[model samples]
Target: MSEEVGRTAQSGWEVGVSRTLPYSGARLWEFLLGREGVEVWLGAGVELPRERGEAYETANGITGEIRSFHEGTRVRLTWRPKDWDHDSTLQLTVVGQGRRSTLKFHQEWLADAAERAEQRAYWKDVTERVAAALAER
Candidate 1:
């Protein structure tokens, strides 16, 4: 059998979407954690705790816990929609060089290939929206 896309023995199913933005890592990091960017990336009403292991819930009914956070670099966390039976690991990363940076959204431990594809599309749309929003500023 052919190996499945985004499948791994350790992580099960996964998906990643990224976009290169014309911004610094520090700037993108701040925006991503800010209220407006939180709504764009995470969800509305999400106020992530500063400490690891702290739990959070969004207005749309998703729940998760913080795993780790690296200032101006990346954040790793657990993500679970209200209807999902299993939790997934999500990592947001920004790597900047010179005047541009690449923002990455990576999620793993999904239930199956279908969910992987679904999340892939979701993140792609999110990347586009984020790019547009940043361009306006």
Candidate 2:
């Protein structure tokens, strides 16, 4: 599911998407944090450290800094496409037990309603792709 909260001007807007997958949190976390796993959904290679304040770049030209990291559970980062004027904050939370998992993703600090809507659609598609990839694994 997906949702958007608050006005774009007041708090930069917030967009969230969630998905349930047939994988463990550790598995999903690897996909989200590991370079090989990122390539599956993002269509790019990412160079990132698992520590705060480290820079990361994707082959698709997206760049950001790691804001926070909690191994096998959560990651927060600053995300900016090559064309965006500024960066946005994105947080990914994984909750899972055994072989089932739920991923909650939030991206805030968007520029406007348009950007929020755009990202909502973008993430929905991306997360769906992620789910499909996990299923194949």
RMSD of each: 0.9, 3.7
Clashing pairs in 1: none
For lDDT, the strongest prediction is 1
Q: Per-residue lDDT tens digits of candidate 1, residues 1-137?
A: 89887999988999999988889877888888888888888899987776799999999998999999988888999999999999999999999876889999999999999999999999999888787777787
TM-score of 1: 0.96
The TM-scores of all predictions, comma-separated, are 0.96, 0.87
After the best TM-score superposition of candidate 1, give how far the Cα of residue 29 lies from its true spot, in angstroms: 0.9
TM-score of candidate 2 to 2 decimals: 0.87
Candidate topping TM-score: 1
lDDT (0 to 1) per candidate: 0.90, 0.81
Name model 2 segments beyond 4 Å from true: 1-5, 8-10, 40-43
